[model samples]
Target: MIKKTIAFKLTSGFVVIVLIAMLTIGLFFIQMFRQYTFNSKEQVLLERARSISELISENQQSSGQMQRYGGLMKALGTLAEAKVWLTDDKGNPAVISGMGMGRGMGLGNTFSSEPLPAEAQKVITNVLSGQESISRNFSSVYNEATLTVGVPIRESDQKVIGAVLLHAPVTGITETLDKATNMLAISLLAALMLATGLGIFYSLLFTRPLKAMNRTAIEMTRGNYATRTGIKSEDELGQLGSSLDQLASKLGFTIDQLFQEKGKISDIIASISEGIVAFDLELVPLSVNGALSEIMNQPQLYSNEALKKDFEDLGIYGLLEGIIKDKKSLQIFKDWKGKKLKFTLSPIIDNQNEVTGSVALVQDISESERLEQLRRDFVANVSHEFRTPLTVIKGSLEALMDGTIDQAQDVERYHQRMLSETKSLERLVGDLLELSRLQSGKISIHKEEIHLPSLLSDVIKSLQTLADKKEIEIVYQGLSDAPALIADYDRLRQLFVIFLDNAVKYSPSSTVITVEATLIKGNTFEVKIQDQGYGIPGEELPYVWDRFYKSDKSRQSKGTGLGLAIAKHLVQLHKGQVSLTSELGKGTAVMVHLPWILGN
Candidate 1:
């Protein structure tokens, strides 16, 4: 029932008011008509009675003829359209005239001089006592309601004698009143119906705009702010609808701008390679991205407390806390999960320049840290390599200058040692320069399709004398029908020479060094140089390609520890990969893989 709207309620109330007004007016009119009808009947009855009384009085003065008066009374009753009754001084009836008794022509004796009814008796008594009376009373003679009027009968001497009365039925007045009441009832019904129809029409006209606004409000709640009310009128409801439409349009535009700004912020955060986290003044976590999860080593560190604890455990919270307290930026390096991480924390300031929150950005610096350490090690290694040969040359020269070697044989030995040291120094300087040139991309390759078998044979023959000095044999395998490689001829030959020399340098006496060349999957060619020598430790295998790194430092006298490193760079310059596998007391194998179909 409450769902019934204002329009329905208003219309129903209007109909009720119309009905009540119609009923009230109908009742008032009916009452007034009834009264008027009664008054008119009484006036007619009184007029007829006055005429009868005058006629009877005239007859009494002219002659002592009661019978003649009764005859005249009957004629007056007929003219008045009423029943007439005449009585003597003793209250005895003399004449009665009306329908059923007599046709107003003669007296009817059958109307037995009956005593009048109590109401009429009272009226006659008052008349005899010299008072005129008019009353509505029931008549026994006529058997209906009648208006009774009695006047005193007097002689010329002004002495009261008998009274004459008249009786008139009031049924006509009641019938007339009833007819008027029915017509009023019908007219009232028509008016009420008309009023109901008009009430409904006005109610709908007024409430249509309100209904549209209600629907628009509901749609706005569902986030469709573009909806509008189409009501176009000059009333208050129309103005309100226009206001609602404006509100929806404004809200839609504002919310759209907010969403676009939010999208841009999210995109910027997602695009960065570092871990970013924002916190409120209370250090509560607001948002975290995928990079932050990886940096912290905790994929579920979305909450502020969890992230804070993680950073604290990694020994980085003190830096963050200092930034928050001091409202300044801070940078710190921390170790987390065996990886070096650099964190930059800065305070976020509001428009008033007051610190409202803070943001932290984390980046992995492990690779960069390792590179810095390598730089330090490279300086030390270079100094050591150059100093060893320079110290030998300087000490030998001092001995000669101080005349410490006086014998001829000792002098020749010292001279050869100096030349050997000079050669070692020259080779070291040359290797360092070559490695630098390769790493800096200053050296370019001249590509040509050369047969692998011919290249390996030339490299082996060039280093055959060195292998023979150690009593180790150099053998080549899988060289028959070998695929041709696209590479710079001088660099490719140098690449093979370095590996074969290393195998010969490290191998035991009477052990065979095998250089295997073959084609592998993915259209790639591989060369494995296996040496039956003291194998490298597993931990040292990963660093073999690093500059100045050597598996057997005790053999530093043979060559600078840059041969394999140089080889690794040269292979990479040819778009190839080099890997080493070794075990203690077993043989070590170095494999180089080069794409067989280069620039195809």
Candidate 2:
């Protein structure tokens, strides 16, 4: 795992190249010096052989002269640092130099009876034929590497008579070459060391800019786009650094612009009431807005996996997949957890008109759907309410017109019945108009300070006759201590009258209806009416405020079902709230809270 940097590799390669060059030069110099020394030695030995051959040839006719020539040969051998030998035409030894020359001269066994070596014999044969010869490898005669040269002992007419051979060992030349080679090796080593140092220095200098650029690139990758390699030069590396800096600058600017656009888009998406989600081609969510999270009821759907899981749970993942696959838009209405949701999925396309991803618009249409249902029910209920009253009036008129009830008492009863049905129709119409006015904000409140106890007394007295028929006792409590509220006097009376009438109508015989008014939290005027009656079913409590919503089918004839609905609207017009609680076989309680307009 030891990573080698560019500098290390460059320095190593430089040193290796310098080493190879120095070694090659050193070897070549050594070979040339060896050849030169050998050539010089051979030339000097040839001159000595020629001179000895002339003297021996001159003294060949007289014994005394030949002996005199032996001494001369010995002296010549000592001076030339070589062994001298004279041989007859038949190749037999005649004169030889001996130990009188010096110690370690390699002059052993001069004039030995043993025949000469083959290579020496060849040299002597060439010399006797009036030709000179030289042999470097004469180890058979000298028992060492020696240079041997032979020359002819010829008469003045150039007739060969004998041969002269000179032998010189090459050990001295090799010793000299060894010393030269040692000095060359030392010089080459010094050169190599100097070259290596220079190579390393230049390598580091060349790679320094590269290293700086590398560090700058690393910093840029880590989001520091401002980092730069400040290498100013007219080289390739400098141009590369300049290019890198320009790339970083452009990339940083482009990224900033993209982020700004993304922020604006995100804000727009979040502000929308409908939920929105974006998915890549893989059907993995890329962006999920806050509205989508809220619609999914999962606030922590931040990760793609979590968002995808929510989509799958809501049964819309398959729709997104189909949109991506078909590159088409799709709309679906789904019921989730008792909520109506509308999902609109469309494929997102690129400039080439190829689908890249999909975007989903989710609308939680539960409230709107419920309102549409309420509209349908309202129309049906209005038709039914009017039909019932009009049918009774029609039947009564038809009976009188046909003389079906000729008795005066029967006719009077029919007249009263028709009047009662007409009155019921008028009440329904008036309640509907009042509800419409309250909801549309067309009705204005003429506000005035009204005492709570006095108002409850008047409401109770108004409904006392109806309560008496059922034997239901109406009681009022806590109103004596309640604070006065700022409200329209007639609206306040109508509000309480609705609650008390319902209580009296629903209560069983001998049952008690309790009406209580209190100031709650010092700012809310609360009125609660409870009755011992057949309570509404728990599941039907939520829709009690809707216009014409009847909780008890059997009690439909007791009063117009618009009472609670109109009462709720009146409470809202006064900036108050209304709620109901009931239990089967027990009783029902209606609670109304009006903001206590203090200091009014």
Candidate 3:
């Protein structure tokens, strides 16, 4: 498959036209030259015959004059390169001279005894009848191809007496024509060569601009739009080159603008928290944004096969197909690896209102849905908590007012119970407000450097009585050399009290509760409170930080379940981390890691 360029085609066509024209002209010239030579030979032969005829007619009466004239005819024939023949009125030969005549003959050898052949007789008969005759092939008279011209010998009164014929070999005229033909052929060949050279030159010159344009077009296809054909002329090729340059310029600008717009779109897509994916009409994944990659748990989402497989696994591939097929928009929900995902699929439409592809906007709504559920649960829990205390207070007041408790000891006991419940209600309200403030970033911490050992001693002493009531030992370890921490003094104390109180409440009377503080990594102050208590189940450990989440159903009435939840928020406010590890019937360990130096 050899590609033929425009220049080659043009050059070839021009060469062919030149060759055809040369052949036509050469053929015409050869034919005309041949005819001209034939005519010229005929005219020269006829004039010599007429002149010999007149000379013979004038010398007819004198024998010596006739002999002298015969010798003169021989000389004239030799000079004209022809054989001279004289014939009588009856078409008999009188004299023959020139070619084939013996050189040593006397002057009186003027007549030939051989009679003329029928073909020569016919020419002589026509000439003696007062008409001229010419023949190119009088072969019987000359034994070769010859040109014979005959003219009647006329007396002074214009009477025909005899005929004079000049026999010239046809070879002479042929040789002359051959020379002319050879010269013409040479000239034609030379012209053809020159024409071919000029054709090639002009063809290349004409196609040069086209070649440049082709090169520029190739560069553009390869994403290089800056190349140009620097051709300037007034011809059509120049106009075409100018057009090509204009198109390249416009295309380059358009591509640059498209790239800029695409970059902006990519940035917007990346900035979005929701996952985004695009698909072609065949439901093959075309593009996958970072958010979609994170949502699908596939970091290398650029691979179309991998992303398509993931879509199929998530049951989204079929949905995308349906959107493209039906040209309809759809919204669906999916739960993938505990993530609640909402996918909005819409068809991409062109100006003709036809669906070209489809795009899927995947929103990870797990957090939002979880928060909504938490809100509902929080309202229900708050109502139940308030009702219980209110019911107890209402019941005791009714009893005291209606005189149901007449004994002084029972009356004072009911009074004490109501007061305790009121304090419990107050504490619950205060904890709720404190947790809310921490979550909403409304509570400000008054940070200061406080000695770790002293802080632990105070927290332990505050809870010592409660631990002693259960005969539980509260031991503080690694606090002697623990570094000071920058945190709110009151909040830190509250955090520790919540841990120790829960520890003592859940532990058996003989068990020991250990509170250990250590400087970890030379930067963090880590506190671990390990208690030999009825530990939380592994399944419930994750939700321990959720508000109002109680692990022990039986112990739900003993204390508010907001302790760990509030501890988590306080730790987070200090830019620290809190975690708990526990096993059923074994024990629970609450670990809090606080940076020694909290940032502003």
TM-score of each predicted structure versus truth: 0.58, 0.58, 0.62
Output the number of the TM-score-best candidate.
3
lDDT of 2 at 205: 87
What would the per-residue lDDT of candidate 2 be over residues 1-600, giving only the tens digit for each residue? Answer: 212777668777877787788778878887887678778888999888877776665665343234445557668789878877777666776667762322111123234433555668889878888789988773644455688889988776777767888877876656676787888778778977887788779878888888888998899889888888888987898899899889889888988899999898889998998888888888777777777777766656457777766678878878777877888899999886677899999999999999888899999999898899999988988898989889999999999999998999999999999999999899888888998898898999998988878988999998989899988889988867555678888998999898888878777888999998888787888889999998989889999888888876754664678998899888888899989999987899999888876643
**Candidate 1's error at 196, in angstroms?**
16
Q: Residue 260: error of model 2 in Å?
A: 3.3
For candidate 3, the lDDT comes to: 0.81
Q: Candidate 2, which segments miss by more than 4 Å at Cα?
A: 1-257, 271-273, 290-315, 401-408, 479-483, 598-600
> What is the Cα-based lDDT of residue 475 in candidate 2?
91
lDDT of 1 by residue, 462-535 (tens): 99898989888888899587556788989989998888888887778888988998888858888999989888
lDDT of 3 by residue, 340-395 (tens): 98999999999999888889999988889989999898898788788888999999
Q: List the residue pairs that clash in candidate 3.
A: none
Per-candidate clashes, comma-separated: 0, 0, 0
